[model samples]
Target: MTPIKDTHPSASSAVESGAPGARVGNFRWVICGLLFFATMINYMDRQIIGVLKPQLSHELGWTDTGYANIVSAFQLAYACGYLFGGRLMDRFGVRRGLSWAAFLWSVAAVAHGLVRTVLGFSIARLGLGLAEGGNFPAAIKTVTEWFPLKERALATGVFNSASNIGAIVCPLTVPLLAAKFGWPAAFYITGALGLGWIVAWALLYDSPETHPRLSVAERAYIEEGRVVTTEAAAPWLSLLRFRAAWAYMIAGLLAGPVWWFYLFWLPDFLQKRYHLTLQQTGVRVGIVYTMAIVGSIGGGWLAAKLIGRGWSLNAARKTSLLVCAVCVTPVFFAASVENSWVTVALVGLAAAAHQGWSANLYTFVSDTMPKRAVSSVVGLGGFVSGIASMGNAQVVGYVVTKTGSYALIFAWASTMYLLSLLAIQILVPKLVDARENERRVVTDDGTSV
Candidate 1:
């Protein structure tokens, strides 16, 4: 990977360029909004099962091991899908890739309503996982295409916060939906919502240069100083040779499980630990995810703010990550806390910090890689994360069964971010863009080759 300097026009330059008739339309933000909604729907579909875990467990007579297996099946399929989905997006572009992914996942989400046995649910979840794996890769790639380096993190955070939004929306609505229409309707409603997003996405999304609605000034602003690569997008396998890829993959491996633990186990934890009903658990889970939304946006903004103050990208991003890591340490004490609300506060802080860490980590791909390769690299990382999450699912299920306690799981969650940070530091010592140093040879006539 080559290190590239950003030559894009500065914010002041963009403002100056938008003179007279050159209106700098803020259409990029409109695209960001679309990505946000897609992600919110993506997560809501996945989170519904977790929110309804107690009801599902009781209804199906599932043991801890059985539930873990269902989750593990999804993770296994998600791992495979992440590898392929990222590459598919790179080859096919976001418009087609995301549309297909959303449609398939939506179908799978609805299929869950028809399943009765654990095996049947596992099959449905596997399908959901396979399709949902494409979401982040496509979203991250879209951000890289539409936003300049300075704004990519904030764009990523803005869209990424949608995951928490989806999580929040799940609890807020799923319980009520299940109560009113039965559990199957919860799946049907969330599943059907994606169909609408799919139609809107197909109608609205396109590359900035190709978008008819984009103004010339806005397109130029987006393209200015971006490294123009003529080489074909790097193969997914080639990304592994770069240390930056390893940094991202390792960080994902360590941190992905923590999020999975929260997503899959948190509601069950509330029910078993505090004896909360479904409605109460939903409210509490919504609160935790709401905090995560704050962290996701705040984390991204903090790094951008630091960059504006002349901090190195490395310093700015890593500093934000370190602060997030420290915030998570308090969660270790959560398992020991006596008051349920205190436990919620501690876990909430940790969840928020994880989102903050994730925002920076996702930005690292866009900051370091060529736009053409961003999706592939992100896919590689997600593939690793999916595998790790699969293992964690099994471990969590087994440990909880044997010990009948969440203490060990909470202890492990608190340490992952710091270790992930260390791996990132070792692998990517400087947050440098890989294409920075490449020189495009020109003929004597000043014509590019």
Candidate 2:
């Protein structure tokens, strides 16, 4: 996709134009709130299937491999959509780009209710996967357009936490809805919420440059940070050459599937291991995702607090990631624990840590890339991760079907973050803020490295 010629002010130019006024209004926060709702809907819609899997399998008589094929359909489509969606955002801008994506995905969510066979569900999920791919790339672009560097991570964390909220909504409510009204009702109801989000987004959102409701002071406040970058947005292929970009992809490769497993398989795990029904797994899974909400917001808050107090950007970000990695190691015991709550504690801690790790991971794009390039990089990283996640889902299905054990998967998930962290350290060596540098470092091959 060709990049659109959208004019945007760098922080340096805006700061040069005028000093920020006192007592800034928080219209920017209104935008953040909207993003939170959009993310919440996005996760809730994708996860509805996972919540209904046990019932669906029984009703339709799906084999493990059959269910995995459905998941793989979504993952494959999701990877393709993610790769292209970023460029589409860069080409079309958020208002137009995100609205259509959210709309189409909502339609896909509703479509799930009409399907009865394995092939039908896979087709529906493919549509959902393709449409939902644009969600985060657009959200990150919106943040870069609206918030200054100092508050960007916090804004990301706040919006990112909505995924936890969505996860919470599904397990807590999907099973109940299915029990009362049938599984179709669960998809129909959640998909309708996207209509409300579309209305709010169309009416409320605009870039800071043109937002009529935003105060001039708030506009100044949003542009106060120094945004250093190359003279222009980096071309997509050139960006592929950077170690920073690959570091992000590597991190996604390792961790994205683990998160995906939690999203799609946790209900099954809870059910098989404990012989819990959909409703029982609902309560237990709800508790697990509730803890994740804390990680999403708290992780960002901790790193932001550190930066505000004088830690280097690198130190704050990496230390927080390291802390998350260590917390996840406890998951080694998650599948083996006898007490269900004990297992919840171990898995919950890891789930929470994953979100925290995710918050910082997303911020890496905004911190290191120009505002113009942020979505594209985030999209590419997601594409890589989505591909890995596809294989992960299929393998998980096969393993569980053959072995009837979760211990191996949990053990695999436990080590990913440490390896991800190691890749980030080795590839990035030091975090480079794009706002402070004019060009990416390049190797002798003339590629940015």
Candidate 3:
């Protein structure tokens, strides 16, 4: 049997000296790379349908409402996935939990090719949504586990940027795949990529405790800033008492639908408004997602940089979010902009801001919440966000179908970040680590917990 090493070590010991010249190994980054590709493949599968929406709708005779319902199917399940996925990761461990979710979602993605009706598509999306729910919870939890406090955001930015890459990949490839093969082939091929990823994930991923390739210096680096925790993970009900958790959840509820709207509806908007061909739309969409990649990584970097410069964790995270929020305001005018490139520029800027906002937002959770509860908290936020997304889809479909305008939705997206930030300010006024409070509470209660 493989040895199960202890998760905690003394933060004071090993204190950086490593045989005068021993270097920290990059194996942790290899672990990060695995996460990167897993996330990439995950988004690729998720966005394929959106990329192929125009063609699918035409071929399958889908009205906007029907399509909205399909999207909602995915959103509803995805929301629930966020809830259950987090808890499962906490219970069973992220390594097994994330892989299992990825495998099942891949199978569901493949099933898309077999379906010909709206109801069938909805069912398949439901399955995919539920399975894909594990991705963020697992990724966030793993990052918290593997990285020290300062490096967490940068590592998260790297993986979260993969979402944009996957989004970019879909727009660039899915349409072409449909043109060359068939629509079903797009789903089949994208889904298969995840199946392949599982092999690599299973072979490579282990907790930092037992990873054979980790160097002592690197392991020491990880432990140096991580909060020492051997206590059992707090229950979900218990975690709800914290204001910080609610702040995170509100951020999700406000901003999540906007991202989903961009992901699911942007292509159709291009088709409807610009009258672009499939190829043209894909190229344009790819460009927008590329901008998002910058936001995702840059957002994470900005906060980390501020923290390095002696900013409080709260100040750094919130400051980065403020910048992103201001950047998103330009997108409100995108709908009314007469020039196509101008519209693209505006939308691209906002999309970038959202990704940046997300990278920081995720790091914020790991920064403030105990590592053990990080996944569950994010899962809860995602669940709330998913619920909002489900409603947003319906609203979008009705508005677009009835009014033939997405002006209202884009306008709302522009202001949501500011509101979310306000909520965060009200709830998490300081950025103290929750673990410190946990230790105090345990001591006060005279309990081992």
TM-scores of all predicted structures: 0.94, 0.93, 0.95
Query: Candidate 3 clashing pairs?
Result: none
Clashing pairs in 1: 2-434, 2-435, 3-434, 3-436, 3-437, 4-436, 7-225, 8-225
Query: Model 1: per-residue lDDT, tens digit, 1-449?
Result: 23245554544476686564365679999999999999999999999999988998998898999999999999988887887898998888899999999999999999999998999999999999999999999999999889877788889889999999999999989989888899999999888999999889988999886899877678767876776655345655556656888899999999888999999999999888888899888888999999999999999999999999999999999999999999999999877887778888999999999998888999998888767778888999999999999999999999999998899999999999999999999988887764552232233444432
**What is the alpha-carbon lDDT of model 3 when measured against the actual structure?**
0.87
| Steric overlap count per candidate | 8, 2, 0
lDDT of all predictions: 0.87, 0.86, 0.87
Q: In model 2, what lDDT does residue 74 have?
A: 95
Looking at model 3, report the run of 10 residues with the lowest lDDT sum.
1-10
Candidate scoring better on TM-score of 1 and 2 = 1
Question: What clash pairs does model 2 have?
Answer: 228-434, 228-435
Write the residue-wise lDDT of candidate 3 on 194-239 in tens digits: 9999999898899987788776667776876455666356577667
lDDT assessment of candidate 2: 0.86
8 Cα displacement, candidate 2 (Å): 12
Error of 3 at 374 (Å): 0.6
Candidate 2 structure quality by residue, lDDT tens digits, 83-195:
78888887778999999999999999999999899989999999999999999999998998888877888898899999999999899988789889989999999789997
